[model samples]
Target chain A: MQSLTALLGLLNLIFFKPYNAIKMNHLNKISILFFLLLNLFFTACEKDNPTPGEDFGTFDLIFDNRVGDQAVSLVNADATEFPYTNNMGQSFNLTLLGYYISKIELAGPNGEYFADEISTGADAAQVKGFYHVLESDPNSQNIRLDRIPAGKYDQVTFTLGIDAETVQEGATGGVLDPAEGAWLWNWDAGYIAFGIEGRSPASPREADQFNPENGVQIHIGGWKDIAGNANMVNNVKRITLDFPSAVNIESRLSPNAHLEMDLLKVLDGHANNVDFSTTYAVHAPAKGKVFADNLAAAFSVDHVHQ
Target chain B: MHFSNLYSFSNSLFGIGLLALLLSSCTREKGIAPVAVAYEFAAPAEFPDPIYTFKNNPITKEGFLLGKRLFFDPILSADHTISCASCHIQSLAFADVPLHGVSVGVNGLSGTRNAPALANLAFKPEFFWDGGVTHLDFAPLNAIESEFEMGSCIEDVIEKLNAHPQYPSLFRQAFTTEKVTTPYLLYALAQFMNRMISDQSPYDQYLAGTAKLSEPEIRGMDLFQQHCASCHDGILFTDYSYRNNGLDSLAIDPGRARISAFAGDHGKFQVPSLRNVGVTAPYMHDARFRTLEAVLDHYSEGVVASPTLDMSLQRGDQLGIQLTDSEKAAIIAFLHTLTDRDFLNDPLFRRE
Candidate 1:
């Protein structure tokens, strides 16, 4: 009964205006403390609420080739140990495995390709030299886009090779320029499209650990038939990012997040075949398509953090 | 006394007003009106569509002025003595004056191949006699940086441009980028060259039915249709495909093979477009011929027998296509029709 009466009295004091409530001894001090507590509660709520362009609200569509986490990879679709080799004695371990990802589009929920792709690479000075070298050391690459507009992009679409229209017609700056080496042909007029390299003990080429004699130089590029190559011009490559929850393009994605990609699947293909003498070479349209499809899947949304 | 003073004051005010109006009228007449320059480039109506339609880069008064400044500015050269016009002279359809088989640049230094004239460049798919540089915008780099030609690096050229007081703003106005890089500069150069489209020749007028080919010219056209049209396809004139036209089966220079590194591509050279073939003479990569008759003689029976000689050239190449004196005259007449007297003297391409 005393507690009930005390609660009623406290409620009455709260309902009353401060001047009236602060009537008893020490009443003024108690009112001041109550107001301070109310202010802190509202401030905390405002701080927690996030909006577009806020620090927490962000989306970085990352691309990666998982391939056994760049450590030990599977060969011939078999659960082989790390650093495994495929049938034609093809092995793994890459240093700078990178190439130009010219055009990219993120798929919307309703399956529309939205193209807002752009490039940020080596400075004008660096691009002018080294026509044959690709720069993919550690974590410097990944079409890291400018803070994109805030919205949930359901699916992502991207092209594998350079757009012929952009290349043939001409672009004065960016990756397409010959001086950059991203798109280069020393003795002719074509471009080196895709590149993937690693430490392959399986390759007879890199056997000389001391002197470096034989190592498989698997370089695949040229103007392939656009009609079939999925990485070709005008092809809309849609990869769905079926998030369990909502995603925000402008907010809610984190940085320093790793999107592990699996390149073994890209090469091995879905047929469960990895004969790789001529078959594993992947020089045909079907191989290009397989590479593109598997590469798209490898870009599944990873954990987001600082 | 008051009335007289007021009258004098009124008269003075009127005098001041008249002087102000007269001053304003004089200033208006002398003021510069921003040079309202007019310009346009057109392809022949009857001809096939142009390959280079000035899409992103158009021919504007400012753009043309920028091109003209760069063309004349020796700042483009390494030593700053030779401009592009040094080799590509205006009077000769913008082709090098055939001093020898190849062109001589800075200090009379000789390069590998002859510099072809800049005519109907907009229609050309491949550039150079051997069809090397893929994009037209990037061609200036080869010339600017070639050790034999201008002998300047692109970065060096950019540095020179950046130092200039007026060029930065001028380049910015032409291309939106503040920093004038090689590609933008090359693009501007190409715009200038590509716009050098010359289709207003008498032959064009004849095709339009506005004029008629002369009797000799008609006969020349017939012969050209019979012999030349197979290789020199249409408006821009050449098929633009690389072929071994019996220049040499095993050329020391290794024409197209230098790029392709292919076995079969030993002496293959891009078919030369014969648009302004008359004035832009001393033809072929080597510029071996001194006259049109010499060129005709080569086609008539001088083509060498080689493993890679064009099958069409089996009959002596030039030896078989040999023209009799009258036949030569007829063929020469047809070649003359291709001369665009109007383009040679086009005021737009002329120096301001």
Candidate 2:
């Protein structure tokens, strides 16, 4: 309680300069009163409060990968079974598919906002909020955000890939660690935020090992926007989804938002139609801008469970 | 008014005291006395502020030593035959030896570009001829993962480090981590590279007014400033800009274009620092020239024009800089002044 008071005093010193011999007007007095009340309210919420509204609970985000209406299933690299077709009618099978999701935010109709803590550092423990959701890894799909205040949340926002600002923070561990399955482009010094690789009969036989004969690999990753250089494109996409229904989060009740990312929408969206025959290999950022433009229409909140 | 001023002054003093107390308390909790920092990165007064993110990876004695060990250890290679030290030798100002123009990597594979001398790297904004890597921490990754260089993945290197008897403990002591991770590994290497500050050369002494240059050397310095200093500018040398210096009419490598994906950037490569140019030969990205004389000759007579040729090199119809034999010789004399013998033979940088 004393520490809280000291913190409030420090805030007063910073915001108001209370130590200075300045005249306090009516507006200043009212604002100070409002600020103190707000501080007290927040302090009360932080403590072990029995208040119903001030209670905190967990919020889970479950990403479900899909191809149009059907759920996704991983196949072998050289599998002949072509399950999905794009707008171009080019059939393809997924050998690998994954994307990095970070900077999560939950919003409500009311003034309740919960932003997941985002930090980047060399320490694996300190690096948080970034999630690498791969079709191969079942455990990586579900992200649980704790310490969310009890509220009725109806919207969620997240960045599809790591931004240039975060990338410039230098080397980071955990999911961002290149040594530990992180899709890092060492030559360009950035992460391959979104990637899908498979083989299509439409795709031509190439000498490149990464994009082999009839192999379709589209990696959307560019996080730098050099001024006046239109060629250097930043393909990192920010996605916001409205929950089908408002879900309540309380001490007793935890909410889960199920989001489905359709592969068909990304490949055959209104912005760009990706033909596997000609547009099979995309390894650079400028090449991935069209696919990144289709990302906003690709994701939707399927449902919410309280 | 006087009383108020006194009160504010006392308040600030109290704040400083509080901060000092907190700092001391932190050290006390760690149970370690305040020791003189041996590995602190001190930028020379004449050099520009370092572009490296030293805040993320601060130089410590343990960390720098660990980095030095990793640098010298060939365990980072695929077959454990090549290390960072393999290409970057300490004697030749951390550049490859003269014989191996393009240093051989794992399994006798040679890279396309010459291994440039490693000095004042902390001041450099980017690495390599392509200038793709933005941070010093990410520079080693290319060498480690490149097909011709270390020919090993970072995952394998980390695994090798974890399994090693000394590496894990050394990493723990350096970074205070339980396990060997990529960031910590990169941090250690960065610590060592950041300490390679070449600021004690004769030219540096000339700048500091402690040493005098010979008549030819002084004339060479004047000529260098008139002709070369535009591209290779300032104290650290090299303006850190990518340019096509008329190296080839048709760029086989497609140098900077490989990274920028622009036709205009084709045949462009980073203008390397001339800090230790005398010892670090053969010169240029492809290691085309064998001697300083040959390099100057290329500048004077052998310049091949291209679309993306540097504007400074193209004087109307003329392709390269005009220089006489005496002028070239004078510039060579001045270039020799940049070779810092103290840095080349520094005991701290030498592998134990």
Candidate 3:
């Protein structure tokens, strides 16, 4: 949708005719015709379909982030309840844990592929093409994708972080809204696709660093074309999960895909053996790539409740 | 196959081209023009893509004029005694005069850091001495709220503008909004400042092959390239990187370190562009050097060693650029070539 400011400007230009009145007059007529055609087209299409779910079933994309068995909960200024320790032997407290999940494409057993269309809120308030799996918000974690072709699906492939387009252009509303204050890293000029800001006792500066009193923030994002000779890298990552067993989807019904995202893997599961003492804050792109790669490896399809 | 058929085909092709051009031009003409003066933001052929995204806040003639008016008005401050122009004068290339080591604000309140020159800001990735503010739109917020500076709240400024008889109408003409918003206000400011580009220096003319440099100036250019071009690189004259140039062994202020929260970043500051270095006297973040000669002397003999000092400035046991008196004079002559008089005198940017 065009911004209100742009629409007002266009209206002002139309009312206060410039030197090129003939051109403006022609533009006005063209714009009217265009809107008329657009209105008619949508109305006709909606009339023909009537109900979108007649041929297909709705599916839920459930993201459960955890540290081993325990569910991840972001605490506000109280970091003493530290329950997790990595291979580096550092007692870390996670104050914030959230990442963007997008571009989900599900493949059928017989080679039928369906791309999950991202829709926000309820059907009435739905906006398409953008999805964010915010860990703190239960509503955001339970993503409802509508109109998946009714059939058995074997594989599900999706990006772990925000798409390159959203990373660069930035979004105005929904999960990507600047006001949401979760994803964007204004200093780096890109979206923090995978963010985990907290503190740990293993930091060289402070022993009780994770104790809310001394918090260290780690914001990971660098979606550039190339990692310049500088210390950062392109940290945006894509992850794919294939189901162990095929799940059947009946027509006009709802199904849920139970997915698990392990937080312990962010440090120990990947090739980069990160030491909390030296690598606690990974804001730069190159340093952030280690966490990004590990987070991509953390997702797995636990089960599919058909 | 026939001559008549070929003639009709060519005529049709020409007609299509004309129609495409007209349609494109029509789309370009939106609202009242943002500026009365016909200035367009075009990066020099040699420069990199500007950090400011024109897509978000497109420059317009009306927007530029409104920003210009707002910039000069003292209503932005708590007391009606100072504006941006009070510290940044046009004659001094938008930098404070020699009297102020650091610029004085409303009620003769003094600031910590010297007011830097305001030119070629669109090309800069970050703003201020420490590279604290990343976006050009948000840079003014720091100055406006600073206790020693304007000391006025943004919400108060907005309320004042809304009450002003002429400003609300001017804002409506520029950005066709029902009421003024902070983002729109920032967009207007960005439009005005982004066009404050200084690309017409004698050095720039030399690069464009439009003017010739004198013998001493030519020699000075070579010397500058060898010694100074690493940090102050490219046509806009800055790499926009933060570095500790070894100004003081113990920094009076921990510069970039305060923003980044890294011990290694201590004493580091954003490399200031030398575009109008001749007019923007009292060099460096502290404004300790009054003249360009003093600045050159500092580099030659007065650099203090520090833990986070830039490796480029370090030479064996000593710190700072080594230069003879004649070489220093020649380098100063070359620095003078960077003065863009046309930009400094541009009436469009003036308070009037």
The DockQ scores of all candidates, in the order shown, are 0.12, 0.49, 0.05
Considering only the true interface residues, what is the Cα RMSD of candidate 3 after superposition?
Answer: 7.6
Whole-structure CA lDDT of model 1:
0.58
| RMSD of each predicted structure | 14.6, 12.5, 17.8
lDDT of 1 by residue, A1-306 (tens): 334444545664675545554465475667557755654454445644443445323445454555545542223222223364553456554443554455555544644334654432212432321122234433434545444555555544445555455445543454555543344442233454555544444434433432232222333444433321222222123344554344445444553333445556655656543443333233322234445544454456565334
Worst lDDT run of 10 residues, candidate 2 chain B, spans B1-10
Ranking by DockQ: 2, 1, 3
In candidate 1, stretches whose alpha carbon ends up further than 4 angstroms from where it belongs are A1-98, A106-114, A118-140, A145-157, A174-250, A255-306, B1-38, B106-109, B209-212, B257-264, B315-322
| Local accuracy of candidate 2 as per-residue lDDT tens digits, A143-181 | 999999888899999999998778878899999999889
Candidate 1: docking tier: incorrect
Per-residue lDDT, model 2, residue A165, is 75
Task: Show the lowest summed lDDT stretch of 10 residues, model 3 chain B.
Answer: B1-10
Any idea how many clashes model 2 has? 0
Q: Write the per-residue lDDT of candidate 2 for residues B1-352, one digit (tens) a residue.
A: 1011111222235675455545545544254443222367889999999878888998887788899999999998999999899989888999999988898999898889999899999998778998887788999999999989999999999999999988999999999999999999999999999999899889999999999999999999999999999999999779888899998899998887877788899998989999988999999999989999999999999889889999999888998999999999999999999999878876668786
Ranking by lDDT: 2, 3, 1
Q: What does candidate 1's lDDT look like per residue over B204-296, in tens digits? A: 888888999889899888888898888888776788766676666477666765544454666878888776788887887777788889888
Q: What TM-score number comes out for model 3?
A: 0.63
